[model samples]
Target: MALGVVGASVCLLVFLAILSLDIMGFLSWKNQFPVDGKTVLLTGGSQGMGRGLGKLLAQKGANVIIVARDVKKLQAAVEYISAAAKSQTQRFHYIAADVTSEAENIRLLEEATTWNNGQTPEIVWANAGAAKPGLFLETPLETMRRQMDINYWAAVYLAHTTLKNWLYPSDASAHSTTIQAPRHFIITSSSVAWCNIAGYGTYGPAKAALRSISDSLRSELNLYNGARRSTATTTKPAPYDVKIHAVYPGSILSPGLELENQSKHPVTHELEASDPHQTEDEVAAAAIKGLERGDYMIATNWLGQLMRVSGMQGSPRDSLLWDTVGQCITSIAWLFIGPDMEGKVWNWGKKNGMPAAPKS
Candidate 1:
């Protein structure tokens, strides 16, 4: 028994060492998602994680364009991003518009492309979303519709518009002999997308839908990517390869979280007490690091990672072999954790009546 335990421990250590090397980019010669000198258009960039990501990208030498409904906040965010820019040449701009409108998203892309000197942004991030936590029966249908509009449909609109431009660029004929950097479409999801909690009826489904979209796009885009590699293709493929990524962040300490807390039920709070709360900058940094390392689904914290592995389903893994290993371990842990969560919620309801219903 002692020898068996020792052998298992040694094997685990070796696997971890290899996984760390892959995640840290030591196994790759070049950064997978290099943003230097690339144009990035980020929605919800006026504040919170969006603003933090804008600043970080600017520091990494990306020309950033932030979109939000608040002109004052957008201006402030542009200033923040400009200050963090690596060089004076790095540009920062802002667009004040509501992303929930499909027409507005189409116009927004046109404006951004014109501002970027007729070049479409190589990196697009759909980061504008809000959460209102409430019980399913108690939540209003209007609130659910609004959540789905901003969280799911808005991303759908943006992704459609961006991918169209990227796949058929105006200047595709001018492509150089050298391959250009691949375009990236990143979506921001929540840890609750994978792990269900009682109070997120209006919010969780939308985030999960976003994750689902990411999964579909990840596979569907492969057809286009494969076409690029074939010499027998009759038509020209996209100018560059396309990559899709989704970032799953746990509870964040930001304006959005404060707003969610206002509507979050007491029971919901207690149930999620174990989730780690990270700052906007911390989450942004971790997400960017994952992008640099070419991760498909990025988790901002340990809890988020656990949730991600729990509901991985058919989504592609960043490191297949290592991720499978991690998933096996997480699956074993979830055997206990999953039932424990259900029990806690059940006991809470028995101990206390339904949480206070929202006043109509």
Candidate 2:
């Protein structure tokens, strides 16, 4: 009876400590940013996770502008979002533009701003991505380049233009009194960025580059925000409340994932079996929820979260105490588990022949 009471007292102490941390902002317990009646620009919004996000955001009364290369898919997505909209004034627009080209991304940004009555998007979702899985030596150089272009460069271009032209524009007229909402930039990376496995040579590296870019952008934006505040004058609007969020999603049942699965080596399947794939709707919900909560890094599942904590760099800490504890646990766990997992994948690859080398 004495031991039971002691255990209960210890649990209570821990719970109260956590509560205190949350109240002190050591754990992120702040109110979520409101999305209602805001303009959101989503790329790769034609199908799969992007479409699901558009529909969900539209239901929340956001003016959603979806951009993709497929006109038919874009139109279908727009219709779906429009149909699901909560308010009669909730707007859904689509722009057919390939995000891989910097010039095209610039044009798309212009179109998005025009569609939103010259108001910049309060949220920019850089969600366009692709993957080509195969042996690194066997994969065509063109294929590797294409993957990088679509997944990494596309995000860079869009984010660059978004910041230069709208979020932190040089033109003073770009600032509008009517639309001074908090700005968010959300990018879709993959779990492979940290939890890499075999047969993902091209795709994993591309995502890793994206992770790096997002980290750098977050740092730059922080500096910019600080500078703007320090140099603020009565003549200019307050500095933009811009926040960057990077999502590291595990497998999801989307067209892109389906394509990747079709060509993925068997060893890849074994590595991923530990984490069951989520639906497009589930991923979309989690991504938006993370953004609303103002998280710097978002992961959709336990494995993704574990991998993120294990490989975490300089990303913002939502819960300092919890995140630090998780990081320590994951770091120690990965020291043994990571090697064993890699050994299994290596043995599987050795048993099965790799893809043929590309013709010289």
Candidate 3:
């Protein structure tokens, strides 16, 4: 009798383990993706994270559009993506316009609408902006204004333009031979949005503003009713609102990190390491994965859900401590257990004249 009881107990334990594993697998799969042919446009697509995303989406059968002020560099990027995606039909486009201008933003969207091979682009990633890492008093006022122009103003202007032009509802027939489509707008944010760092007098504020705007837009769009025929001029979404996702990440290793180190405020923010600088290709892969899964918050190098849980708690100091420690252990675990592909915040130790974050 005792042996039979022990056998039953063992069977119950095994069943519970399998159930738990299945649940966890579903949660993880919630953010993984199947390939999507949806069109995507990336601003600041000349290099770094933008270029990375442009290539990944193109490779995934997406019609990718890249826009920046550098024409020669843009052509080079097109060739690079063409090689990466290996698809002759993977259309690559570029429009040279400074995003800060409202007229320029509108013109870019108009161009995007026309370039879609008679279809509308359904995804847009606004990754253009300036980040001057310096103390508030040390950085020039003009630099701060420029950050706001590119970061906050340009993003919303593009979001509004994309909606009004490409995603807007029209009188087309429901029976028409058109594919059912949903649009999405993704904005790049930072951890600085939640906690302002010591040297982000300029960079932090602009990201915070972007965070606020993205939240408000998401809330309003979610409340919209599509059946209503009323014309709302506000930045509201249609009944089936386009998904707006905010990607909050820490330091990214880009060539711009080299320039940031060279600026007059040399020892400003942290820079990436030479060995483990997370390539732009990796960042782009993670982003496309997150977008296809419709994740609202994608922390590319997420250590664990602990950071998000900590962010939900009150007390600024406590939040910072939780985030810093969790991120460290999480990153360390990646090195030891998983692939080092998860994002890591590293220090350059003044070799490039960039200020290193005080040792965690």
In candidate 3, the residue pairs with backbone N, CA or C atoms under 3 Å apart (3 or more residues apart, or in different chains) clash, namely 226-239
Number of the predicted model whose lDDT against the real structure is largest = 1
Q: Please give the lDDT score at residue 151 for candidate 2.
A: 93
Off by over 4 Å in 3: 1-35, 170-179, 225-241, 264-277, 303-309, 312-360
**Candidate rank order under lDDT:** 1, 2, 3
lDDT of 2 by residue, 59-86 (tens): 7888899999989888888998889898
Each prediction's Cα lDDT score? 0.89, 0.83, 0.66
Q: Report the error of model 3 at residue 99, Å.
A: 0.6
RMSD of each: 5.7, 5.2, 8.8
For model 3, residues 245-351, the per-residue Cα lDDT tens digits are 77766556787666665553422333222213357887777667666555665656653143333343331221234456866665565455333222122232324
Q: Is candidate 1 or candidate 3 better by lDDT?
A: 1
Alpha carbon lDDT at 356, candidate 1:
73
Q: Tens-digit lDDT track for model 1 on 1-360?
A: 999999999999999998887664557656787888999999999888998899999989999999999999898889988999999999989998889999999999999999998888999999999998888888889999999999999999999999988876667442555787889999998888997788898999999999999999999999888888999988776668889999999888999899999989887998988778898899999999999888899999998887787679888767666678878999999889889889988999899976676677
Which residue pairs show collisions in model 2? none
TM-score leader: 1
Candidates in order, TM-scores: namely 0.90, 0.88, 0.71
